[model samples]
Target: MSELRFVVQLHRARRLHYDFRLEVGGVLVSWAVPKGPTLDPKVRRAAFKVGDHPMEYVAFEGVIPAGTYGGGDVIVWDTGAWVPYKDPDPGAALDAGELHVELFGEKLRGRFVMVRTRRDEWLLLKKRDEHAVAGWEPGEHPLSVLSGRSSDEVKADPEWEWRSELPAERAALRLKAEDERTRKAEDERTRKAEDERTRKAEDERTRKAEHANDTEHANKTDHTNKTEHANKTGHTNEAEHTNKAERSNARARKSADKHATTRERMGEGARASVHERGGADAGAPGPEREHTRADERERAAESAIGGLESLRNEAGLDAIGENGTWEVYGRRLRVTNLGKVLFPGRGDEEAVTKRELLRYTARIAPTVVPYLAGRALNLHRFPNGSHAPGFWQKALPAHAPQWLTRWREPGSGTEYLVADEPAALVWAANYGGLEWHPWTSTVDHPDRPSYALVDLDPGDGTAWEDLLVLARLHRTAFEHLGVEAGAKVTGQRGIQIWVPISRGPGFAETRAWVEGLSRSIGAVVPDLVSWAWEKAERGGRARLDFTQNAVNKTLVAPYSPRPAPGAPVSAPITWDELDDPALRPDAFTIRTIGERLSTHGDLFSPVLHTQQSLPPLT
Candidate 1:
């Protein structure tokens, strides 16, 4: 008899059952077998005749939803070809009441016989054969022979609709990746094009400069020839002609030099332009572009005139006892009496010099400039030494460099120093800037402060612990209104808490909000905190000086060095640190603050970024 394709599907419906299918007449002649197949010669399993199913059902393995026909998990248990035991026509024998077959499968291999015991009911028995054993069972191997999936895995398979979207999702991700590559390539191409344009422009400038130099040389040569001819032709007396020719030659030399200088300047301009565009300066002249002695001195008198390396070198070049000019980041500033102690000796310590102050400002500029930039400076000038009395100058001194940006007050006509960049800070240090106090508002919005400050000015009896408690109370009030507040040690004897707010509200509105917040805090700690504006009414409690949020009022900015003996900074602290009992006002000083900053960058940066509104006052 011809061997036919056979499949055994282990199906799990309300009860577990095995579907035995044999390919016959272009369809699968199916039967449902409970207790599964057995290879034991003595064992017999009950089988119920089922209707014909599609031949393709041999490979199907998945979950069928509940309430559907034969709804349950189904998996292909075993599949292989089978041959009739002895009869040539097994289909005719199957119709005749008894059918016998030799089975070959991953899990079932033996001589099996099916005999009709009743209407639509048959007994499948394993015959005594070489492949049959006394205790062999198919139920011991429950996984699908095709997919290795068990009944539970088949049951948990997701719906086909959801699984079908994976290919499309993968395609979209591939397209997005390709688009990003294309965009990056386009950007590189555009950058190259711009670079090429800049190079061409620089080449043009070089050519023009060279042409101008050549013209000047030619004109000078012609003038010299004319003067020599006049001397030889007897057109004028020899002595007088010689003197005139000398003067003419001098004029020609001056004119040629002027042209050469102009050409050099043109090349410099081209180089600067290229640098600004971040393009290659291949055509730029090298060390030959060094400024003349006059230009050098002029620039030195103006600002520190160099890059980082140059600044570092110039910083050490000056003698301590002399007045000299040095370049710092391409600007020049004059420093006098580098050896003179700006701050006198205290206890076992010696003193801090003017140069030390400049170096400190230069060293801290990268971090300090951002805090001071765009904010008007109230300089605490200590022209003598730190021990001597220093005066506060709201207006920048007349000697301030022209490069320094200044903000003019509305009615007072006071021009305040604006440390717009690192160089400006260096200039301030040259002007004996011992302490930096920046206005609450920036130059962008002088009347509208970016944050409201609650300066905790402690009375004689007010403890540091009480100030910490008050700071927490302020934070609580701010959080209740959905605002984020930061705390900082004042570097002096007190503390300040700051809440970032939207810039749309003027200082008046912010001050009012601060006042409300202060009142709420005062009510919470009535004995320890005071909201009264007057210092006398604080009853030895810490004053919540909300007036510091007014338009022109300022608190010591974060990271700003105080003029104290140890150069303590007004350092920003996390709320957790603020709550620590060991947190001291003088914990972070200039000497140690730099290391902390390198580890934790700009902790108070949120003050310049986050925006929040105050809740309506009750």
Candidate 2:
């Protein structure tokens, strides 16, 4: 072999990991070792096979812009040549699910054995050799062999350019953003240092005043003693003693006043220093500082939604008129009845108007748009207040904008709106759309769905607590099937779970599979679940509605605000929250969803990316 090269890059990205690669077939066949390699022969490391990279990447070390693959810092930790120990060509052996190799890298020098455990999964074992150490850890030596720089150093330098995975323009924009963030942090540090300097100068001035006072007191004592020696020595002694006592008292008072002043200044400085932190009182003392930070965090959470809550003074803006043209995503939209209230005020939540609804939809577009994209949508419109009346709009209106994605049903020839972007969502919301329901399937393949559905609908007489138990059962069933699923509050009286899959099965097959899974789960706890089509027959149990997998059938899209009381939103929840006694389907409303999104970003985002398959039913 012509000097087969290998490289192990210590990647401190979104998470710390290592990219282990070997040059083969003019490309770098790579594997991701999360904890990095160890020399202990007894230790077998897990390696997940990833896509091949170009040979040019062997010397690559730099910062990857956020949102890109392995977006963070990278450093060439170790690199050298490798030779097949047992097989003539390592490539053939790698394909055969086992490979024996002798590494001659800067840090790693040993005979290693690699064996495949599953597709894209492998075990790398260090062969017992002279090079093997008992407790070899990766981070003990973090400097890159190529640049002698750590991953942290690489991330801090703008010159450590990002690779071309992102478009040049977008990448440049991201680089600019990074520069801005760095500049802001630097500015904050400078301000903090300046505050410290100011406080120190004040203290120095106070100290100087105290020194001056002490000098004056000493001079007075010296003059009094000289006068006593000159005349009336014995008579002046008692008077001199009284004067001395007065001088001592004056000095003590001055010192006390100066110290108190200094303490007050320091407290003020501490407050000033943390003013911009938004979630801390850095100047506080001991446990007070800790408690202040916690309080500030709670306040910060509230402040995050300040804009949402300040529904006051919303009327006076030409930015949005009762009826005016608004441009969104390069499309001009004419919105009417901007001040018309669609949802009445409930308790602490302010009444939601068409304008406010449009704003909320636009604000949340980035998080919600992915779920709506590529799918035909059904809008539930409430022109009047939600308490008054509402109706579902299935077919797209003829007057709908031409730019909007339109899909024609195969049989009825009725067209549906495919809201695949922010503008479309805002436009729909402006038209009295309260609840948005996107089909489980997309426009391209209406039959093959990428998500299997499970809607836990609480029937008559079912307590909210019972649904919680039933939801837990669903988690158990999903785990047993070895599929990843995401849960969400339906904003009404149900919980919706969506399992992202590698689409191959048609809607019929997917529906059947979900139904089977639901049936099995129901069988486990018959009292808590209902499979009965009739509402009264179920005796108030939560129904696992798997029928939503069919074509044209839809559930309220996540983050979609329901027209029910409190303007509740269909919000995403973590799987672990199912067992939480405090979990409530109605807790997340339009007023609070923003803060949740800010604190815990897109909890259900994995549903858009996780492509795990449910093992075939025997």
Candidate 3:
């Protein structure tokens, strides 16, 4: 058995290529690949085959001379034992233009095929299925690290060299070519440096010219001012004074002219100096700069016009056309007539009369739907005319109607049935329900149940101090009763307090509890607060609307539009904002409440699902 070892030195002539070598058949086979051997099965690297080296070359390691062809320190990137598969003849594989090998090294262990394309070119491919990892990319496979010498290391180490024993004729030609390449590279660097210097000099020249122009303008302004002062005064001595001033001015003008001339000369000299320094007009603005400025102005003008139009629309004095009339909570409302025209005809076509339309109007009112408490009903006529003709429409009743009915006390507790129309039902379901809002049901969200809502009438000229006192008193009463209470601005002249509790003992029980609490608090704070069942008449005290304690009564969600009381809404508020007398409900609305909720998930969320003991008010 014979042991074969050899080393072939390689130089990747390109600045970005890698040098590779391998020992085979008592000689070193070398290749120079721009991109090193890729373990990726898809990529075949073109490795140019250089001539071989004798077996003794395996121990050769040293620096090649600088300014010489392939001058650098040579380091062994990889050393390994290889088994070549081929015909018995030593040069048989080379002549056949094909080589097969299984390499085993410290870093690389794989089966590879090197097929010669020409006298000096070959292709290296990994037998991906046999030896490389399945689905491996070049850098992903650990075995690919065999091409470990990075490009940076090769460039940084000047002593690294590729020592090849080439024929004398080839060596001479390679040396001459390397020297020429070096000279050209140095020349290019010098040219770039000169160009940079020229640019700086030109900029200096422009600055000097601008400075001289500014001085000349100042001198001309001084002359014009003196002439104006002389003409302002009219007297016998004016002529004498003007003559003396003229002589002095003439001397000053001559002196100024001489200075101006000198400045012009200095500027010219500066320009000459710039030219001598090889400076060009590198400071001139490019076309892109002007386009950028124009774009900015156009955007500003567009923004201004949009803002003006928005302000005009918000002023709201536009044409008030008749939309239609809708009755809500027994109150008649005149809305846009568009709703009636759009209404889809339904039921036996008696052609709905105006009075019947009024009934429909009352039925679809925003407040009435909740009162229906989720009972399915047929919409014989639509106020909006959007529904299909004769289509049976069911009111979105309360998911838990029994709870709402029990809480409202339809006949006994409170006149919970304030209106019979669908509109009244919607309003009651939304504002007067066991769960407060129909959309948010205690049955659905046991974790964050809503509370009963009430609106109060704070009479005109009510002092902020008085309102605060009433709020504090009510808060005290709620705390004493062991109820979890929170307060907020009603977006109007009153304060709204929310009591959080679980749906225990049904809605009637809760309503009874709240009513008792409110009456007791009102009696205790009579000087500051009054519980008036009816609207106040003239200079009467502000009234605590006890009717709000009724079950199934809802406060609008923090941002819903309230057409009454000037389109205000029940807004979620910070404790600080609630304390401010100037803050109105208009500042809050359903549109703006989401942002606050995201930061603090419903301030009353914790008490919603909790049960509390309602102590009798002291």
- Give the number of the best model, judged by lDDT: 2
Q: Please, what are the lDDT tens digits per residue for candidate 2 over residues 370-399?
A: 789988887888777688756566656535
Worst 10 residues of 3 by lDDT: 407-416
- Considering every candidate listed, which one attains the maximal TM-score? 2
lDDT of 1 by residue, 532-570 (tens): 433454567777776565544577767666676766778
Give the RMSD in angstroms, all C-alphas superposed, for model 2. 27.7
For all predicted structures, in order, the TM-scores are 0.48, 0.49, 0.29
The root-mean-square deviation over C-alpha atoms between each candidate and the true structure, in angstroms, is 36.8, 27.7, 40.6
lDDT of 3 by residue, 554-606 (tens): 45333333332222344544333334555554454323333333333333222
For model 1 the local lDDT of residue 213 reads 69
Worst 10 residues of 1 by lDDT: 167-176
* Candidate 3: Cα lDDT at 201: 48
lDDT of 2 at 551: 52
Q: Which stretches of candidate 2 lie over 4 Å from their true place?
A: 1-318
